[model samples]
Target: MDRPQIPLNALRAFESAARHLSLTRAAVELCVTQAAISHQIKSLEERLGVNLFRRVPRGLVLTDEGAALVPVLTTAFDRMSDTLDRFMDGRFHETLHVGVVGTFAVGWLMPRLRAFEALHPSVDLRIYTNNNRVDLAGEGLDLAIRFGDGSWRATVAERLFSAPMSPLCRPEVAHVLASPQHLEGQALLRSYRADEWPRWFEAAQAPCPPLRGPMFDTSLALAEMAAAGHGVALLPVRLFATYLENGRLARPFEAEVETGSYWLTRLHSREPSPAMRAFREWLVDAARAADERPDLLRENALSATDQSL
Candidate 1:
């Protein structure tokens, strides 16, 4: 069976009109006169022998048939636009859309990204930052870097680095926290994760502080709040190194608790590309180098001294 021919101009006019529900606005978008837009729509309707839109006094409204077609047309147009955009570069390149946790991007990956760019100059990288919670397939993300227990069901996880939580506060507030137990009386800034504070306390063998402060979506936010003297935040020492090094924020004690390790994760069904493989290799090597740093008194690997931290 042969399909009927579709008028490109008429379809464009109808799609625009359907989107804005106004011929005038559609004309503005199409860069044509309103009369031209109306004529194209009418021509489309006459050719199809069906009413695509109902013109009310104020604006146009899509009929049931038009309403059903809008999404399909919109999706097709969007995909076409995206595909065409890649061809405009005149090179065969793959786009890797990666979603990274905010804390990791700021604390670790942002500084080291130049190395990856140097290696894979042809691969286009689009990074979306989220707060640990990510949708791999729904967001069309190739990879997600997050701190977790490696329990995500549909993803393959590769361990990157461990984040340890400890009491971090402004230097002025550090005096109030003489011991791990003293944290109980101070204002305890919290994360969205309910168990973080309690788990940290358990690891340090200290009493849990009364949870009373702003709950931050990211450790970076919590660290900033702590640096501003709002309250004490249980932060990943590795992530908040800049503040610690610059004396903006200070660790009250040496009590470090293993919160979770950062992981490079992707959908189990996602096939690996050369660019992805290179990135993974580079990331793993970086993680290993950080772990093997021969510096404690010599240099602060866990503190803000290491760029990867």
Candidate 2:
């Protein structure tokens, strides 16, 4: 059994006419005469043995067959156009869409983006910043830089670096803190995580204080709030290097807890494209390079802590 071979011109004519419901409009779009458009459509109908359209009093209307065929043709044409547009200047550009957490986006990735662009000139990289809540498949992301314990379902997680949580506050707020137990009296700002303060307290060998202050969805906001002298905020101090150096925030105590680490993740079902592979390699190498350097994160945290003391 062989399928009937149909001419592409006739298919195009039918699809265009069905979309506008007017052969005159289809002719204007296709740069063909109305009679040419009508001839191609009629040939197509003769071959298919079905009436694709009904000439109504006002304009043209699609029959059931035409309605069914229009969507399939429209989608096929759109995909083809998208594929063709990828070719530019003798190069096929690869588009890589990535989702990054807000803290990492501002503090880390923003600085290193130029290096990535310079290295991979053919990659059209798009970044979407999130508050550590993202969907890899639903949002159509190639990769996501996330903060967690590296345990997401249907995701292949790669450990990037550990971000130890510690108490950060304003200079005036730090003056009264002699030990972790002293934090009991201060207004403790918290994130959505309910156990972070308790976990830090457990590590500090002190009882967790009642959290009665404002809660933020992002560390960047918490950092600003802590810097503004609102209250003590338990944050990953390493990511707030600029604030610590500028005397906006201070690490009030040395006791820190390992709540989780940063991770580079992708859906398990997604095969890595060349651009995705390039980004992953670059990110991993960059993290490794950072780790090998003199520990600035510790130095900054200690320096801030010492300044407060």
Index of the highest-lDDT prediction: 2
Ten-residue stretch with the least lDDT total in model 2: 291-300
Candidate 1, clashing residue pairs?
241-304
Per-residue lDDT for 128 in model 1?
98
Quote the lDDT for 70 in model 2.
94
lDDT of 2 by residue, 1-309 (tens): 677789999999999999888999999999999999999999989988899999989889899998999999999888888888989888888999999999988888888899999998889999999999999999999999999999999999999888888888887788788889898888888999999999999999998877886789999998888888888889887787777888888887778888888899999999999999999999999888876753677777778767765
For candidate 1, write residues 142-215 as lDDT tens digits: 88898889889989999987877778887777866667888777788988889988988888887785787568
Clashes in predicted model 1: 1
Clashes of each: 1, 0
**lDDT of each candidate versus the true structure:** 0.81, 0.89
Q: After superposing candidate 2, which stretches have Cα over 4 Å from the reference?
A: 304-309
lDDT of 2: 0.89
Q: Quote model 2's TM-score.
A: 0.90
Error of 2 at 33 (Å): 1.9
Best by TM-score: 2
